[model samples]
Target: MPRETDDHDDPTRRTYLRYGAALAGAGLFAGCAGEADPVPEQTETPRTDEPGTTTETTSSGQAREACLFPVGCREFTDPPDSVTTYNMGWADMVVALGHADRLRTNRLTAPTLFYDRFDIDYEAGYPALWQDGGFSKEVFYELDSDLFLLDPNLLEAWDDNWDESDTAEIESTVAPFFGCYNRRIRGEWQLDLGYPEQAPTMLESFDAVGTVFDERARTDAWLELHADLQARIDDRLPADPDPPSIALINGGSAPGDGEFYVLSLADDGYEMKPYRDLGLVDADGFAGIETGQYGLTDYETMLEVDPDLILVHWGITTGSVTFGGDGAFDATQFREQFVDPMASHDVGSQLTAVAEDRVLPGPTAEQGPLVNAFQTELTARLFYPDEFGVLDLDAPLDVPESEQLFDRERVRDILAGDL
Candidate 1:
């Protein structure tokens, strides 16, 4: 049945895009309860129930169930027949748990990422594969998967009324869907949510995947590693007086303007719940943008802010190439040609983020796990190196002169800027 437009899930884009002024929390838009949840799309054929195995805990008080996934840890007594996995998030989580080979079929990102990851780029590989811009249904169905861990919002690609609709009546065999709380609302993914960076989120996802995989030990280990990283970041925060205020800028092709589309911390400060997971985005400190979508601006507005540091995280989904069209960090021609000139504009130039060279894009081709962890740390390190440690992002992108950016003391010195 088609969904009613007025349903809670189908909030109008015009109104929804306004974002209702988020309050502080773990994530920006409540990531729809659990990440494993999927909006019922087409389901797979059902199989007879089979005997399920139980997980055994390790000697260190960690169970096979919790070891793999650390956040939403649960003992999935009965593994679903032919997982009809839905989103890219879990695909990545599963791989990290050392069980990706068992995946039935995934609906979120594509397989090209799988090949790329197993072969070349590990950073951008996972996210690129799942949310990878180039997903082909022919290839998707060809995998013949069973359980579906999906993001309900992706239904917009098939049915317009999807947010309010239900596909359960169709007799398709599928598992319950998981989703990031905020992802339930359409277009919410575009906002930064200043939610904890990707690392902890992945850990949380690991917890969720652990419940299904029953790898408590692995999940616990991952959690320990996650905590260690957080501690490392926390202990390292710059002690110098006058902590710098940071801003994130995105490169865009729209309006041919020089400024990047900006993203703001949720509820103003950085210390939100999700920030706790990633140790960034304190809501009490700074205010975020309200409009949420890409907008053109001149150099003057940037100077007005007098940003202590400026960081670049560019992506133009608003272009003609999005929405079933081919578009992603790789497909865009901006990196080689427009990257420098775009940053060198009025606002791009005056800021210390630009002059001292503190910009970093948010993609790593092969390190799927690291890509998930990039956001909070990438930006945090740029503004407070003494605290966050020196960050090296260029090498992963294989940018020419990438080594220049890798320098411990002065990264921007050797990097190229062509604008």
Candidate 2:
């Protein structure tokens, strides 16, 4: 459960208002400091399983001037040396871009575990500012990072107490917030919550981050690797094959007992991008849960659709096995505490996925380009074991030479600037 905190603070309000007034009068910028055009609503369906196809790249140029969004734009003259990152997605982007050394603050409570999962080495005692502390404006001031690789919309989503004014204060006093909230599939609730601006796709957000860091060449290299991986996957896809119907679930974050937050694939959020890109049909989208994002569904709601497969998404929260639940991320704990319990539950046992043992853990929620590549491979194995090889859960995630989707050594070299 989240810590209960008062939404209103009279003294903080007074202080913020006074400081904001001064900054505005002095003509401080409130938006990003890089140039970007308005992100158009992605109405076109994702590319089919056709070889030699590429998605267009909208970001270019090396000199960071301004990043445009629906709200406005912010200009940047100097690259940031230190950055503050929120959650696994932002942290992963920094690591992927060879800027992990610049991460001043990180969200993963177990930094070593994250490093091990990604197979990256860092200082033995690398310090972290905080983890899952629920975004403090005071901490932002104290850390005083050169840039914040987070979306203002996300800050608001996490703590509705924050608004545009709060975001402005961070940009004016400390540094600009540069990324988009690329997680959720847009829903009606998002508009009601005051986040009407559509977030960028994972690739788009990464490109923006590359622009901010003046690493367009590295970004291009990564995109090339991604294209190659996609081409491989496409070559293996059977022509006009009917993919299985899937219901994505983050069982860890049940708002209450016996309920789960069901993810909709309709809007193509970052977490579902790989699955959506592969043309897997979302069972929930077919069921028509359109008005809600991260909607809480009970056993009855789940049983109604009875998807062919159930994908359990990971990293919903740090340390805890279940969001707002007391547990950890160990294999024994996962099965004993989560999998076994759910498998035996009256409602859970009745589901088609459980009966066929089709309930499998999905990819990490905090995804980057490389992570997405891994996820795409994982999904292919899960859905089409006859076509792609079965995934070895106990073994290291290293793919065999013939089975490798992308060159790991080459990616490492690019990130290490040895390219």
TM-scores, all candidates, are 0.54, 0.75
lDDT of 1 by residue, 1-419 (tens): 11112113222352221111132233332232223322221111111110011123434333334211111222345544344444444555555555555566422233232223233222221212133332333333444444445433344333334332242311133234433332222233323332222212334444555556555555555544445545555555545434446554433322135434554433211112223333334222224433233433445655566565553333322111322433233433434433465355655566555575544443221122323434344445544555455554422322233322222112111111111
How well does candidate 2 score on lDDT at residue 188?
Answer: 38
Model 2 bad stretches (over 4 Å): 1-63, 66-71, 109-119, 122-134, 156-160, 185-198, 253-257, 284-294, 315-330
Candidate 2, 1-419: lDDT as tens digits: 23212111111222223222233333342332222232332212223111111122224433344342322234555568888876556666777788777777635433343345446754323244333545577778877889877756555555546666888888899988766555553533333322333345566566666666777678778777777777777888888867667877664544225666666555445766667666676785534743233455677677778887777766322234223333233444445544565577788778888788676666666677666766777777767666777765433244576776677678778777775
Worst 10 residues of 2 by lDDT: 3-12
Q: Against the true structure, whose lDDT is highest?
A: 2
lDDT for model 2 comes to: 0.57
RMSD (Å) of each candidate, 1 decimal: 12.4, 7.4
RMSD of 1: 12.4
Evaluate model 2: give its TM-score: 0.75
Best by TM-score: 2
